[model samples]
Target: MVSSSLFNRASKVFPGGVNSPVRYYTPEPIYFARAKGTKLLDEEGKEYLDFSMGFGAVFTGYANSDILDTQMEIFANPVPEGVVNEKEIILGEMINEAVPSMEMMRFTNSGTEATMHAIRLARAFTGRDIIVKMNGGFHGAHDYVLIGAGSGAATFGTPTSPGIPEEIGKTVLVGEFNHRESLEQIFEKHGNNIAAVIVEPIMGNMGVILPEPCFLEFLRDITEAHGALLIFDEVITGFRFRYGAYQDMIGIRPDLTTMGKIIGGGLPVGVFGGREEIMKNISPQGKVYQSGTFSANPYTMATGIATLEYLKKIDYQSTIRLACWIEDKLKPYEDMGLKVNRAYNMFTPFFNQQRVWDYPSAVASDSLKFMTFFRGLLKHGIYLSPGQFETSFVGPAHSPESVEMAAFKMVYTLENEMNESGNA
Candidate 1:
């Protein structure tokens, strides 16, 4: 009742009663009272085993003691935004050291800013206008990224959102996730006009899709051949699988890399960096302009440092173990005509029978039935990502017991309660 009432009040001010489109649902989104690790307690005092994990931002888990300690230190010191701080320098060094391709980098307020600036930097450095993005790949909410986004934007019923000038869309080219010929055709035609090919090496916003073998290497080679920069958008995938960027694991160094989410330690942050010759193009060195009052704020930098420090010592295999346990339990989902796609610890149960490898396949999932299962799980004290297009993450925060309980409830719901009629 309190959550319902809060939603009613919020509706009067915020559009759709939510700041983010993915946060809204039919009955009304539940307001969280508090969160710790993989648990979220609602205003109604209902506890949920959280599989969303701050939409893949809370890598080390929510309300972590180390992050809390950093908060306390910031409070005692009263570090304000819009100042150069030693903490920022330390965080920059940590990221550059982890992802060697990022010889130099710049921090921003959000992933959108990072990608927007990266696109501009690429254009300025190359003196070309076109940016090619994968069909389902989501860089951020900026205009160029939103043009050809997949399921994430599809939640709002449009892959190419309105209000963007027609000319802006012309600057971006769309390519298939795993298919190589799509890129071949695009570059063959517009290679000279292309400033960069911005892509998500491992797609996350369109659910967890891994790259095909040699696909990334091909991207590296083709971009170099055409004189275009290769940019890896690691907003969600940066540290999701390992301590470093995904490009490093694949042995391909992108000309630029954009990162956020986990690197921020549950705080708002974004970073874009690459080879020294290219990064120097950003303002204070070259002409491309990018600045924010919150950029390199002390709080986020200190919190990130604490998170990386904690991350260095923990065993990431724990997350994989949890995923494997749920995968075994959810084998019944396949029997129910659903497919679960996983990349390391992040996974999604698509309402499609075939394996999902790209944007087209991801879009084919039965979203209506997914909402039915989603509602059923919610009633059973589980909080998954609200859309079929979104991903469910397991981190150090999730325990085996919580995952087991969630799996059992999910199975029970699919077996006895599901209608496939969109009726919860």
Candidate 2:
């Protein structure tokens, strides 16, 4: 009947009363019945202005009509299995046009699979075993990207999840983001053995931390100098920023790029693409093997194509304007010693005053204060990412008025709850 009651039922079968670890917070998680546009309806039929945006997966907003229409059309006319479809070609071409680095492409069911295969491709191509990842960058649930990851891992204070073999951990070398010296040290020690250096051009997992000026250039140069591939794990930042990948906007080109979230138009999909020479190495074509039963399923392909096409027609400047407006409203709270990081339409308000350039800075944020702020905002009909480490997203569906209201709620929460606890 209510979120609490539904959570009680969920706890019986699911761990921590939710399917995903990040979905469950201290007292309880809000169970949503449905979503439309920029609002979510919980089990109690209460509406909240949604800023989580399905963890950056719903950039076009919940239940976008164009994506839905394409989905319906595809389902009406089913295609035979083991046959390539037109939607796949159209979507891939659009993606390649937007991101020129994707000379070749492959589709998968989730971001985890795309990242995993991308790593494998790198190792096979370079004939090396080591993977160098940013300390707080989260690629996915896969073992290779889990070492010192952020997001739910950071939220739970468990950088290294259990059940992952010690051997897997050894292959991954973690370095601080925005700190070139840290990476240089790793390269000096194991440059010859490194297969690739994977990073998120703009970090979403560690709450929207931006890459410092020329930081991405540093990565590109170093990886090239080391004879290793540079992988941009753009799963969260991909279409959320632009129609293309975020790397393009930063003026850096990686050897490989992994994308998910927004491209699916709120469905489940992941794509990896890179230089033709590197992609040629993938199986049926080369030695490294990767395949999925639902790879580029017609349904997802159609929606992805529709989503990109629609995005190309819209003026994203308005969304950015609204985000800036929200940021302006929240600046007073920042003056009181809170750090707010914004990247395009997505942002995060870290409870710490210091700018979060790396994992240590991100971890230094006051988690308890964030919890209080989060709960207070929830009470005011604003939905935020449950985890402090995760980024909050706003889309075209979120109007200026809605954002202003959310910003007002944020300030109120900061003044009443955060200040009461001596956080502000």
Candidate 3:
């Protein structure tokens, strides 16, 4: 049995015994001593091939030497007085160059702050009151973005949290993912009132549901027609799916885009940016205001610069190829009654009879079976995201050999689950 001493101590001081609700598991989270590359070594010295990948932030890998060196360099020579750090300047320039839609970018400490500021900018620019978000999509923990939050929110069975005032929740309209009709319904009713429509082009929070054909185009069309800004919350899909934003992959240009995870290079960072016209609405340029003391802290900028520079040199196609291989390897499991699926490097093996397209379907999956399979995989030295709604990430750290090992463990875990249930 794992020790509850750490968790027990944590519960006394921290809510739910974890700093982040998503990190909390049924029994308790495993305390890790350290992580290197694709592997995590727990406090008890148990090793597991980690697929969680810091919630898809550590795209380059854990403890990357290049990033560490850059971080050290930043530490050695603090920010020069009256001189902006070259790393932040370079990162901003690189992002603007790579994603043409983002003419000006402002860094934040996390995705929540990015979305919060983006929404504020949209409202200020458009002079509108309402914000539309997908029913199961998660933007971040802020009251405005947390409407119909997924992951821990779904697990708790409260689509919208209780602490938020009724006035705040009323402004957040929820639409269904992949269903343009639902969006149209919401838009037709309150199109003029909406300041912005924020969406995850590839729905990562709700189990990797890809947008239906022309769904993104419909969003662009409707939002444009209604004079509402379309904000693509690419916190998960920004750099992971492709070199630029996933919006580029789908051939749609969002008025504003919020990015986190990989952009931070495993450090705490978030960014929101878009056309110069809308961006000017923020801070010194316009009436709308947003700021953070640690927004562009030199350490995070250094790590982000190193990570993006390294990413520019990587063969993204090769990483996608490895993901495709893992997908192919798991295809057989679907025939065995497991609902295995993949979208980019995010993959899931759902123990359900039907496909999961939205929050309802996603929650209908067999959580108990997933829990069993999760324990089985853990026993076999493979780590997976603890919840059914969360996606299992594959990163640059996971090589073909490491993926093959994980595949074997997954198959064995499924087989064991089937056996115990007398379905094998």
Candidate 4:
């Protein structure tokens, strides 16, 4: 039997016995002892291929040799007090150089911090009160952005968390993901009072929902016409989909952008950047204030610099080709009455027959069927995210061999699930 002792001890200390609610499982959670490359070993020593990738943070993969070496080098020499370290400077310069819109960048501890600061900056810059967000998009656990979380939040069917005050929640306005008309209506009514419109650009949190054609351009046009700032929450899509920002691929630029995941090279890091005139509104330049003691620590900076250096030399088209291969293998599952959707290296296999477009469609996926598929994949030594609403990630470590293995496991799991459901 799996151990419940760690969870039992943890429950009394941490709320839900996990640092984040998404990590919690229904029957029991497996405790991982160690992880390397694309695999993780549980406490009981069972090995499974890991597609979670620390919730899409480990783009280069776990325990990368170059990142490890950089970490060691930073630890060997402590930086002098009151002096800015070279690693931090280099990482900042790399971001600004690669992403054209980022004239100035500020680091934060997590994506939540980056987004929270971005919203504040928008409010400060535009002098407006209301903020707009996509219906199923998740920015972070912060009150403003938590208006509509996708998986665990959607599983419970309460998109809005309980602790967030209704008064504070009222400041947030929700719009459909790809529906331009819904956003237009919201802007038509509250356009004058709106300060910023924050979006995922590619909605990874809601199971890799790609924005409708010209959807991002529409946001840019609307926000600019209304004198509000557009903020692309590229925490997941930043470095993974492309070299800099996914916006570059979309061919539209937001006034401000928030980034996370691959930026830290697996360490905890977040950053928000945009034009210099708008960025200068932040503290030390203007009144809007944000600060963190360990925002640009040497350890994370070293790892980030090393990761970017390696990423700069690699070919993105080759990585995208691998993603297409995985998607092609799973495409036949539609014949089994399952709806499989994918974008770049992120993909999802929904149990329902209908195409998932918005929050309602995403939640309409059969939960029981998904649970069985998830458990079967786990038994077959392939690890998927515990919740169906979460996207399964592929990275540099996931070779074509591993993708084939995962495809076989998925096919077997789907067949078994269909047989059990009397639909085979």
Lowest summed-lDDT stretch of 10 residues in model 4?
149-158
TM-score of 3: 0.94
List, residue by residue over 1-424, the lDDT tens digit for candidate 1: 9989999999999999999998998888889999988889999899988999889999888888867888788879977668787899999999989999999999998999999999999999999998888887888788878876323311111238888777787777888878898888788888998999999888888787889999999999999999999999999888777788878878999999999989989899999999999999888998889899889888889888999888887778888888888778887678677888888888888888878888889999988888998988988999889889899999987888888888889889889778755657
lDDT, candidates in the order shown:
0.86, 0.85, 0.82, 0.82
Q: Which prediction has more favorable TM-score, 2 or 4?
A: 2
**CA lDDT of 352 in candidate 4?**
74
Candidate 3 lDDT (Cα, 0 to 1): 0.82
Q: What digit string (tens of lDDT, one per residue) describes model 4 on residues 1-424?
A: 5548878877899998888889987666778889999999988899999888888898888888867887787778766533477777899999998888888989887999999999999998988878888887889888888775224211111238788776665667787778888788888888998899999988877676777788889999999999989999999999887789898987888899999889999999999999899999999898999998888877788889999988887677666676677677777877665776777888777877888777778888876677678877888888887777888888877887887888887887776655564221
The TM-score that candidate 2 achieves is 0.95
Q: What order do you get sorting by TM-score, best first?
A: 1, 2, 3, 4
- Which model, 1 or 3, shows the larger TM-score? 1
Question: Which candidate number maximizes lDDT?
Answer: 1
Candidate 1: C-alpha RMSD to true structure equals 3.1
Question: TM-scores of all models?
Answer: 0.96, 0.95, 0.94, 0.94
Candidate 2: tens digits of C-alpha lDDT, residues 1-424: 4777888888999887887787888667788889998899988878999999888888888777867787788799876555798878998999999999999999998999999999999999999998889887889898888876323221111238898777787778887799898788788888899999998888888788988888889999999999999999999888776677788787888999999988888889999999999999998999899999899988888889989988987778788888888788788777676788898888888888887777789999988778778888888899889777988988878888899888888888877776544222
Stretches off by above 4 angstroms in model 2 are 149-159, 419-424
Measure candidate 3: CA RMSD. Answer: 3.6
Q: What TM-score does structure 1 among the candidates reach? A: 0.96
- How many pairs collide in each candidate, listed in order? 0, 0, 0, 0
